[model samples]
Target: MTFNFLSPVSDEVLAHNELLTPQALGKKLKIHSKAHGLPDLDNVKIAIIGVLENRNDINYMGSEVELDSIRKVFYNLFPGNWYTNVADLGDILKGDAVGDTYFALRTTITILLEKKIIPVILGGSQDLTYPNYRAYDSICPMVNVVSVDSNFDLGDSTLPIKNNSYLGKIILEQPYNLFNYSTIGYQTYFNSQEEIDLMEKLYFEAYRLGEVSKSISLVEPVMRDAHIVSVDLKAIKASEVSKEQKYSPNGLDGKEICAIARYAGISNKVSSFGVYEYQHSKDDHITAMLVAQIIWYFIEGVNCRVSENVLSDSVNYQKYNVLIDDDELIFYKSKKTGRWWIEIPFLPDVNNKLKKHTLLPCMHEDYLEATQGKIPERWYKAYKKNSF
Candidate 1:
C-alpha cells in the first residue's frame, strides 16, 4: 500500500485493520533537513520501522497512543524531504504475546535486509533487539551491537520477557564472538551483582555515567566493528527524559545522547539501528523534541557517512595507529614523511597488541580507549620519537 505520513491510510485498509482513520490519526508532521535536502525514498538507504507494541510486563509507561504521538512529533521535527528515500515501513501488526510482537518485528527486518535497506526501528522494549539482531544474523556472518542503557540487560531468563531482561535473552541466544557489544551509561541501581558478574564473564564492555563523558570517544570504534546498534532510551538520565516509566532524576543530557546517535550514523559498518523504550504518554513537548532530535541525528549521521564515502575504499582503508601506555593509549596517523603524528590530542585505549599497528577507516580516539584497545598494538607505538 502507498505510505504517506502527510496523508491518512485508505478507508478500506483502516476498516479491515480496525485502525485509526486519517483524521483521527492526527495532523501530518514535518521535519526539515539540514544537509541532504529532502529525502528520496527511492534512494533511501535507511528504513525506519516504528514498533508500538508494549506487551511485556515491565513498568513501561504509555502504549500504542504514545507511539502515534511520537510519529507525529518526529514528522514535525524533521519536516521536509530529508528522508525522501527513507521510507517508514510502518508499524508492526499488534500482538498479544511478546513473542508474537517480536515475531512481526523480526519478519519486517528480514524483509528490509533482503531489500538491502538499513532498518531504523523505533522500539517497543529492549527485547526488540533480539529480533533485530536475529534478522541480521540471517544475512551477516557476524553482527556487532552497541547498547546504550542503564542496565546490563543480562538478567535471568526466569523473568518474563519484559523491557529490562530482553537483552539478556539475546546474549544467551546469540554467539558472543559475533557481537562486539558494549553497554554504555549504565547505573548501579538498575543492575544486580549477579548481572554485573554475568556481564564481566561474557566480556561485555560497560561504561558508567561518570565514565560516559570521558569515554565518548569509545563509541566510534565500538560501532566501527558493529553491524547493528541498539539504543535504549533509559540509558539517558531521567532528567533528560520528558517522560519515562522509570524516570530517574538524572540521565544523559540531550547533547550527549545526540552525539552518540551521530557516532552511530557515521559508523559505516552499522547496517541497522534501533532506539527503544521512549514513553510518549508521559513525555512533555521537550521530551518529544529531544526524541525527534535523536532521530534527526541518526539521519544526519547516515547522510554524513554516505556522502563522505565512509564506505568507499578510499576512506575505508585510511589507517590510524593506536598505542597503549600504562596510563592511557594514544592514536597516531602515519604521515607521508613516514613519521607518526597525533591528529587529535586524545588516543584510543586499545589492546596491547595494536601498538605500532595500523587501523582501518581511521580509529576514533575515544572508542579505542573505551573498548580498552581491542585493536592490535603493532599498529600503534607507545613511544614514538614525536610523541606528544
Candidate 2:
C-alpha cells in the first residue's frame, strides 16, 4: 500500500557516474532565456505522475523503468537552478486490487488538479488514460482530449475495461463532447470498420499516418484546442522504437513524436498530459533514449510556455464547453460581442451547420446549469462561443 517516489537507483551508483539527482532534474531543464516568446513559470505549476503498473496486455506493462530513464535524462539535460515546482507524485502502489490501483491513480490526479497544477503522467498502460480523464473531471467537467495512437482503442462489444479500450469506457461514461476528440496516427490494420464507424458517429476527428505526415499543419490546431493529451508509445513505428502493442510498420519518426510533444507542452489549455504503453522489457537502448528524448522535448516545451505567459491570456476567461448528446457533442465558438456560435457540430452529416446564436446575458443559474456548476456562465458562454 506504500507508494515509492524515487526509482531503485542508488545515490552511490549515481554519484559514481556523476548522474544528476532527481532534485536537480527540473533545474537542469530550465529556460533562463525566453525563446519562442513562451510563458514563464512564475505563476505556473507542473507535476509529474509516474505509474509502474503494467497489466492487461503484455505490451502495456513495465513503463516505470522508462520513466526512470526519463528522470535521469532530465537530470542530465537541465543542470541549473530553474523550474517553479516540480516533484514526482510517485508510483501507484502495485499488488493492490485492480479497483484499488484505479482509485489510487484517480486520487493522485485529483490532488494535482485541485491545486491547479499541470500533470505529466508517465503511464504503465493506456488504461491510465481513463483514470487521468476521470481525475480531470473533478476539476473541469468538459475536457477536449487529443489522443495520439495507432488504434481506435474502441474494442469490440466485449467492453475492454482493461488497459486497451478504457478510453471507450471514458467516452461512454463521461459527458464528453466527441467533437473535441481527435485520434491521430491510427493504423488501419489495428482498427476495425465498426470502430471507425463509431468514431464517425461520435464525431471524433481521426487522421491516418499517411494523412498526418502529409498534413502536419492539422496537428497544431488540435493541440491548441485540447485540454488534455494522451500519447501512446505505439503510435511510433516499430522500425523507430519497438515496445508497445499495435506497433505499426509505418508510423511517425522520433522527430515527429518530439514535435507532437512540443506542441502539447505549449498548449496553455492542456492541464494534463500522459505518455503510455512503453514496455522496457522489449525496448532497446536506442528506444529508451528516444523515450527520454521525447520527455526532454516535453519539458523544454513546458518550460518555454510557462516562461512566456501563455496561459495568462486565458486565465481571466473561461474555456469553452462541449454539449454532450447520445450520438454527438457540439463545439461552439463565442464572439467577442457575446454570442453563442456553433463552430463545429457533432454530426458530420449536417451541412454548413455553423451558425451563431445570441447568448443571454450571464446569469449564475444558467452558468451553473450549462457547466453543471463546474464552470462560470460567462466563461461557459464565451467557451461555447469559441472565445477562449
Candidate 3:
C-alpha cells in the first residue's frame, strides 16, 4: 500500500532521460515511470527515493520541494565501473499531513531494508531522518546515527518537531533503539552551550567543522559504526551551493562533503543515506550537480567495499596490545584494507548494547596514541557508554 504512495518520475525527466548516452547512469538504471510502472527490484543493490515534504522546516514558507533538477543531473552523469544494479523508485509526494508523509516514508524504507536494498533518499527537510530512523525499529535492536550538520539539532524536545530540532524528539521518543549518535562538521556557534554539554554528558561524539576540514579521514571510523547517515545540505558553505541553498558562510565545501559521502558509502554498516534541507530555486544547477556528484561518489565507494571480519578471522589482521595506566588496549589492523579497530573490553556486570560488536573502528594513530601511555578518546568514550 505504501508503494502506491510513490508517484512515478516526472514526464519531463523521463523525456530528458531518453536523450542521455548509452553509458550514462540513466540508461543503466531501472527507472520507474508512468509507462513502465514500478521496476523489478530483484538484485537491486541501491534504490533511490525522493521525498517532497518540507512543511517541518523551521523556516518553511508555502513553497514545495522538487528533485527533478538533481535527478536530471544525476542521470546525465556516466556510471563508474560497477557490478551492482540500481533502481529509481520515483518520488513520494507530500500527503495531506506531515505525519502521513512520515508514515509513507517509514513503510517504504522498511520494505527496501527487508529486500536488502540501500535507500539513497533525496529529502525535502532534514526532519525526514526521524522516519528513516524509525524504519529500523523492526530491523535492528540497536542503531547508531551519524549526522552531518552544523548544529546538534537537539532543539527543545517538548516543542513541536522541526528540521532544526528533530534529533531531540529522536533522543526522547519511544522504541529507544538509538544507541549512539555522532555529529560531523558541527559549528560551535550554532549550538548552545547546554547542547554541547549534553552531548558530552551523553557521551555522544561531536567533531568540529575546522577539525574535519583539516582531515576528512577522521570521519571514516565514525561512519563505519553508523547504520543511518543523514546529511543536511545546509552544512555546506554558501559558496558551494546555489543562492537558495546558501545557509552558512562557513561550512563543508563541495570536495569535503563529497569525501564524507564516499566514506559513508564505504561503511559496511550504513544501510540508509539521506541528503536533506533542499530548497527549490529558479536555477539550482550548481547545488543539483554537487548533490549528484555526492551520490556518484557514494555508489563508487559501495562498489569498492571490502568485507573483513576482523574479529572472527585472525589471519587477515595483525593484533597489537598496549599497556597504559594499568589498562591493556587491544588493536587490530586489517592486512587487506589497512583499517584499524580497537577492542572494547566486555564487562560482565553492566548491561551492554555492544555485546556482539566489541571491535570499535579506529585509526592507526589511535593505536600509536595508546602506545604513548595515553588512552584514545574514542575508545574511552565507547568504554564509558558501554558501561552505562
Candidate 4:
C-alpha cells in the first residue's frame, strides 16, 4: 500500500546500462522498471529511494535533482562479495508542497521499516532527515542519529527549516523519540560557538574533522549506537568529488567518508540511512561515482557485520573495572568480536531511570585510558548525562 507513494524509475535511466559492462551493477541489482515491478520485499535488506524536493533547501533556485545522475554511476559499480537482498524502489516524486513530500517520505520509510528494510535515501536536501527520524517513532521506542558532516545543521527552529538547519526541527519536534544524536567530522569553522555549546548542553557528541581523519576507528562506537545515519556529501574534500559537492576546501577525504559509511552499515542498530546535498551539474560523474562507492562500502560492511557479541550473556564477555578518583568504571570486552563497552552506572533517586549498569559502546583505547587512572571521555560524558 505504501508503494503507492513511489513512482517507478525512468525508462531512460534503466536503458543507460545497455553499454554491456558484464560486471556493472545494472546487471546485478533488482531494479524497478517498466517491465519488472518493485522487487519482492520479503528478504530485501536494502531499498534505494530517490527524492526531488528542494524547496526547503535554502539554496534551492529551480535547480534540477541529481538522483538520476547518482543512479547512472551506482548502476555501473560491480557488486561485491555480499549476501543481502537489495531493491531499487524508484523515486518519490516531489509533492506540490514540501510538507507533502515530507509526509510521503515519512509514510514510505515507516512502511519499509515495518518490513525490516533499510531505506537508503538519495535526497534533494539534508532536511529530509527529519522525516527519516520521524519514521522510527512507531517502529522503535527510541532512536540514535549519527550525522557525518562538516556543519552541525542545527539552525534556529524559529526560522523555517532548511537543509542547513533541519537538526533543529528533529530535536524540537513532538513525540521526542530521539535517544541520542552524534555528529562526526564536524569542522569548527563551519559551526558557531553557540551550537557547540548546544551540543555540550544536550550531551550530544561531535567529533572534529581533523581528529577523525587522524583516527577513523573512533566513529565505530557512535555508529554501533546509531539508528539513523545521515551523510551530507559536502563533508567530503573538494579534490575528491565534483565541484558541485565542494562545500569546503578542507573536509574529509573520499576514503574517510566512505569508511564512515561502512561503519554505519556495520551497525546492528542502524535501520535507515541517507546521503544528501548532491547537486545536478556538469562533471557529476566524479561526485556520483564517489557516492556510489560509499554505498558499496556500506553494503560491504553490512555483509561483514559480526555477531555472537551479545553483552547480556556474561559467558560471551570478559569484564574489567578501573577506578578513576572515587568512581569505578566497568568495561566489557566481547570474546567473539573483541568490541568493548563501558557501563554507565544508574543514578540514585532519579525519575525515568535507566536500568542499572547500562552498557555504552567504547573502544579498547578507552579501557587503556581508564587503566591509566583517567576516565574515558565517553564514560565521563555518559556518567554526567546519567547524573542529570
Best by TM-score: 3
lDDT ranking, best first: 3, 4, 2, 1
Tens digits of per-residue lDDT for model 2, 201-259? 65567888887888675576567667778998888987887444336678888888888
**TM-score of candidate 4 to 2 decimals:** 0.96
Candidate 1, residues 149-247, lDDT tens digits: the string is 888776667766666777766766644324445787888877888878766655556778777777676566556556777888877766676644446
lDDT measured at residue 117 in model 2 versus the true structure, 0 to 100: 74
> Model 3, 152: alpha-carbon shift in Å?
0.7
How would you encode candidate 4's per-residue C-alpha lDDT over 4-120 as one tens digit per residue?
788888887888977749878777777888687777788889999998888888878888675877888888888888789788989988898889999999999999998888999
Where does the lowest 10-residue lDDT sum fall in candidate 3? Answer: 348-357
TM-score of each: 0.70, 0.69, 0.98, 0.96
lDDT for each candidate structure: 0.60, 0.60, 0.93, 0.86
The residue-level lDDT of candidate 4 at 168 comes to: 90
lDDT of 1 at 13: 28
Rate residue 368 of model 4 by lDDT. 93
Better of 3 and 4 by lDDT: 3
The residue pairs in collision within model 3 are none
Candidate 2 error regions (>4 Å): 1-18, 21-44, 58-66, 79-85, 157-160, 174-179, 242-246, 306-388
